[model samples]
Target chain A: QQQVKQSPQSLIVQKGGISIINCAYENTAFDYFPWYQQFPGKGPALLIAIRPDVSEKKEGRFTISFNKSAKQFSLHIMDSQPGDSATYFCAASHRSNDYKLSFGAGTTVTVRA
Target chain B: GAGVSQSPSNKVTEKGKDVELRCDPISGHTALYWYRQSLGQGLEFLIYFQGNSAPDKSGLPSDRFSAERTGGSVSTLTIQRTQQEDSAVYLCASTLWGGEAFFGQGTRLTVV
Candidate 1:
């Protein structure tokens, strides 16, 4: 029930296109959802995050479309660039609990030039 | 360092030897967490500590793995009798409240 399943183990997209990664969870107690971007030989960095109170949150070129009822959320990258090429991970955690994040099997994205 | 810092960025030890990994979270952050990441895999929660509260060690893999946080600051993860299966990257993260977390570069342990 703690699992967050992510789709498209790997993705290849052209520049100027949209890159979308989807994730689903089973635990309904999760209130905070965050996406992380990680490069080789580096730890995951917090990219963008959202709460169940809002359905969608956008920051610059990154957008987090959340579906509380469906128990799913997605990260959408507009105008995907080569610099954005990296592994993305979706994570969820309950605010009231210990704050331990449950992450999904990462999705490796490759933006073609 | 301004961010979470881990020691011995790379450690290659012999099997059956004991190894200790360190984590120095961002100053003033009360919440700290430890995770393990294998190649091409997701982060595996190992433990969590919040201030002086009792740590949540439910995610620890075995008896050989243990950790301790001193004075609500630096933390050390001790792996006793390490095996080759323990070869992986150990990551540490910290957060101020209940929001996003900041991660360190991580310690890559290669048990040969």
Candidate 2:
């Protein structure tokens, strides 16, 4: 069963625009949420992460907005650039469970120059 | 090494054959993980190894899939009687107990 769910399997945006991806989960045990960026034929890399303790976390132009009670989280890319075109995955895990990660289906983002 | 290294970045195998994929984790990393990604699909957890404790094999699809970590550093994922459905990219990752996970490039396996 898929523990985490993501929307917009694919999206296209003009450069300098905002790109957003949303994810939700039903497992309350999950406390750590992270986003990953992957290029073609390459493994996914960590982009940003957030804990339920915080409502939002931002790194550079990337931001993660989390809602603990709603069990929802979203990634927002500000001024999306062509280089940001890639697959993004949202994952959840809890520290007590040996950090066993549960991932959502990926979203492929395309930024047109 | 600076990061996790996986051997034989690509592998082509015949159905019914057995294949082994290797992963070298960064030194001192106590947590290791194996995940599989099919074309245009999400990653599927395979297995996990942490320190000297027993590995978690609950994610393995079947008995045909098994993995072993030697000296808690290098891990080998073996698939027996490869099937066409077994073809996928096998990715490895290593991390500290509570730190970020660093992933390898992954081994793309094609079972013909």
TM-score of chain B of each: 0.98, 0.99
B1-112 per-residue lDDT for model 1 (tens digits): 6999999899999999999999999999999999999988889999999999999999899999999999999999999999999999999999987857999999999999
lDDT score, residue B92, model 2? 97
Candidate 1 regions with alpha-carbon error over 4 angstroms: none
Q: Per-model C-alpha lDDT, please?
A: 0.94, 0.95
Grade the docking of candidate 2.
Answer: medium
Native contact recovery (fnat) for each candidate is 0.78, 0.63
Docking class of 1: high
Candidate 1 lDDT tens digits, A3-113: 899988999999999999999999999989999999999999999999999999999999999998899999999999999999999999997667799999899999999
> What lDDT tens digits, residue by residue, belong to model 2 across residues A13-108?
999999999999999999789899999978889999998989999999999999988899999999999999999999998888788788889999
Candidate 2: TM-score, chain B only? 0.99
Query: How high is the TM-score of chain A in model 2?
Result: 0.98
- Please list all clashing residue pairs in model 2, or write none if there are none: none
Q: Which predicted model would earn the best TM-score?
A: 2
